[model samples]
Target: MKLKKFIISSLLAFASLTFTSNADAASVQTHRVQKGDTLWKIGMNYGVSVSQLKRENHRTSDLIYIGEILKIPQTISAYEKDLLARLVEAEAKGEAYAGKVAVATVVLNRVDSDLFPNSISEVIYQKDQFTPVKNGTIYNPASEASKKAVNEALVFRGQGSGSLYFYNPQKTSNSWLRSKQVTVVIGNHVFAK
Candidate 1:
């Protein structure tokens, strides 16, 4: 009887473990396109980016009809989002709103690039990649606008200019960085590839 009870407990434990894993594995959230719904509007409504929406739905254009369903990718976790926001807050603290988005994009671009680390934390914390991580400002609470900017960077969904690096020209004399082709100039930050 004791052996049978032990076997039952083991089975119950395995079932619970499987159920927990399945719950954690639930990732996709679907949104059926509504009348007058634009990708930007849908992304804003769902706290995702329009670019992500298009990519996930296999759409090359912004056009979507009513009753069309979209797969929302939640690959980036809350902690990663918060970390990114904090980096934006620290890096582009006094820059324009567009600059803030651009700053976040640099990190995201690195994440996508095979040359850099694959994850946000890895990219941000890698060696001398970001000053905020080195100076410890990355742990500070991200401003509401900064957090919004990070989401917009990840989802605001305009095809990014492929900027891989940004620097304050006034602050950095790194000739190699300055020598790279400049993509866009926003306030004090110069974005380059």
Candidate 2:
């Protein structure tokens, strides 16, 4: 009788664990925002708060591009697929993976410093800082390489070269950079942490 009770308890515990795992797996999904979609609409559809959607998607501005993919916490399967897709895109278009990570790190650092916006979009879109925003590069529909680079940077927390600054050798000439020294150079960019 004792052996039978123990077996039943063990089986019950295992079944409960399996059910919980499945339930977690079934939550979360990725939705690519279309031209007509709004944050509120997406949030309502996903049964999450609009603020949550905006925060998770890292949208500083109210406006969103047509082709941008928004991750929704509706199903785990969709979330993973979108996450993988974004990672691939970042790597493919990222001309300087090292440089990209450095840039990301700088933004993150700034956010932590309390001298800059706390969100990724806010940091990247800050005035006169990032070239992509200033020159419309950020809105240029990021290349696959860039997407991959960004994903790698986000995932790995910007490792490699430890560069906190980079410059185009062809465009910049200053005593400061020369004094700073080089940490790593990738493609047309240089990085320093």
Candidate 3:
């Protein structure tokens, strides 16, 4: 009787382990490291941080073997991409392509800023933050250009000039925004910190 109980317990443990690893496998993908590849570049392609890659692979250094199979975490969710794409569409309509990309970068910059919320949703929906949200334009569907711009923004993440704000000089009468130093003038929008 004792032996039978031991066998059942061991089987249960094996089953639990198998299930857990399979669940993780669904979200984690393997990448065979290639020549001329840097951790930073790999992280950019996969929309993950270098630290996350290193931690996932159990490495203490940035060094990776050319043939090593690295476990890459899943990329940003579809919902986040869709939300960002929609925002860029509403905010950068009629603006240059560069302006659209820059607009998305500003939202990502806010997500990384200490002064703003740490999430895209929180930063976008914060009280009186964006005119589109208030005007109900944020709900509009995104365009292909805006969606592509969002993807490009993710690839070039952290390309922000510490810019946390953007506005059209001819449209906005906000003295506070005007007082801030301008970083880039793309199309009709003035990107600023």
TM-score of 1: 0.81
Best by lDDT: 1
lDDT of 3 by residue, 1-193 (tens): 9999999999999999999999976866878889988877787567666666777788888888899889986657788888888999999999999999899889988988899998888888899988889999999999999987886777666645778899998998999999998999999999999
List lDDT for all candidates, in order: 0.86, 0.55, 0.85
For all candidates, the clash counts are 1, 26, 0
Off by over 4 Å in 3: 1-14, 30-71
Per residue, candidate 1 scores C-alpha lDDT tens digits across 1-193 of 9999999999999999999998876755888988898988777666677777877889999989999788886647889989999999999998899999999889888888988999988999999988898899989999988988887787754478889999998989999999999999999999999
Which of the two candidates, 2 or 3, achieves a greater lDDT against the reference? 3
Instruction: Provide the lDDT at 32 for model 2.
Output: 85
Q: For model 1, what is the alpha-carbon lDDT of residue 155?
A: 71
Model number with the top TM-score: 1
Clashing pairs in 1: 49-155
TM-score of 2: 0.44
